[model samples]
Target: MPGAVLAPTSAPGYPAHVRIHEVGPRDGLQNEPATLPPDVKAEFIHRLAAAGLTTIEATSFVHPRWVPQLADAEQVFPLVRDLTGVRLPVLVPNERGLERALAHGAREVAVFASATESFARANLNRTVDESLTMFTPVVARSLDAGVPVRGYLSMCFGDPWEGDVPVTQVVRVARRLSDLGCAELSLGDTIGVATPGRVAELLNALAAAGIPADRLAVHFHDTYGQALANTLTALRHGVTTVDASAGGLGGCPYAKSATGNLATEDLLWMLNGLGISTGVDLERLVATSLWLARRLGRPSPSRTVRALSHQEPRE
Candidate 1:
């Protein structure tokens, strides 16, 4: 994009290399209205890896009743199982989902929890504590099988039903996940209502509570166009892992107020300018997103994609 803002040299507290945990294949596509064929989904994932995404969330083992789009997890997993040099993690809501993922040879998996009561009910159909209880065994068994678990705590900032979630509430849920054998916790701005100050406050709280910055990741939605700003704040606080989607694809079907996850291309734009290395090739990444946009029959919501689409070739 022509208006790219370059990251200043020697920005304080920013990591040299940020690990981008690409969630496009799973979280990005799960909310789409049309279901992509298993093979297409597999190819999309392959392209993401080709664009230098090392950790790509492949699919979810969620029941079709909740997310019908990813019901073919069994079919999709095997198609991309043999891809070398990439870590493919699947979403496992409970023990059954974990079993399904294991049956297909998944090595890494993620469990999602909510930081707010209303989100816990709407998304998981259970209270916050109950949902965490449900994941206890799932996390335990997955770790026992030599698989690492990623815990996702959604609605960490603001909830659609309950506005302005307390920082303590988020820390409570995040701590539980960390203690439940989860190797890492991804705090999510599910509704994109988080600002930079709030992000700093939450991270400080987590740090003060003995949660190391390395064990946490940030997943932001662009509902209010603050994803990048919030992410900058997270980086300033020492978060090295970020969750993003190609083509800006995703929204919470359960939480209607939410929008797409932060676009991988947009994040790359800022990261690249700031001298942060993510190993992603920006041109290849944009091409991959554009290809996906064609499949979804819409233009990408990414500003970088739009800017590059209209730009003249550089000499």
Candidate 2:
């Protein structure tokens, strides 16, 4: 119940435009125990684009041994890369992953590391420094090829193994990523343990570290149902980009007690109600989430989709 207060109505020099990056195809589906066929993932990407999501994380190019569900990344990447009016970014763990992504016509790639030392070792099987070092060549190669690289800093909040993460550590990791030429850095509340105050404090620290708000994005999970409130905190601190998943279909495999991500449907609803324009079709988006949930053999986890579907249709 912390941060129950609404975010401030205004902050000095907050960006006018907000961007929502769709991560359902990659982060959402990848952690699911069941494997979704490449074609299904491709179709889901297509539908998300049709619903007006311009930026979507299509798949990860990691070795199949690590994420078996995304083993068909090679096939899925090519299918979504050519989708008109959408940027499909693939996650790359190292240079080898980047090479595979580039082979599939990847124009943008993401390199991820964790903020908490324990989570870094558990998730990437490397220490914080080691994980960043492993992706140095990957970032250099992407820069050489003129491909945009986004850095993901996971466990920005508390970690399962290492309880509350230090803001100083988060700041250090994020500063390193920015110094590495990552076009943008995403701060992830990997297990959704953030309070609005914590989110605000983190953003303030990053700003103090000389990382501009324009180069920052937030990825929040809804494990404790605080994602939306935490998001408002990010907005107050001038974070203009967010990462959300359709139907709330994602949870981190490495982080126990984590729940689905901040749902795209839920995010859209809140944004629209706040008079923030996202250029998305809400009804179409709801239908799409329902369709995907059915395909995955589970009910949609998007509370907004469920409520809106039952209410009197909006004009």
Locate the minimum summed-lDDT window of 10 residues in model 2: 1-10
- Regions of candidate 2 where Cα sits further than 4 Å from its true position: 1-15, 311-315
Q: Who wins the TM-score comparison?
A: 1
lDDT of 1 by residue, 93-172 (tens): 99999999999999999999999989899999999999999999999999999999999999999998889999999999
Candidate 2 at residue 4, lDDT?
22
Give the alpha carbon lDDT tens digit for every residue of 76-173 in model 2.
87777878888889999998999988987999999989988898888898999999999889999999999999999999989888899999999999
Clash number for each model:
2, 0
RMSD of every prediction: 2.3, 4.3
For all predicted structures, in order, the TM-scores are: 0.96, 0.93
Leading candidate by lDDT: 1
Error (Å) of candidate 2 at residue 31 is 1.4
Model 1 spans with C-alpha error above 4 angstroms: 1-10, 311-315
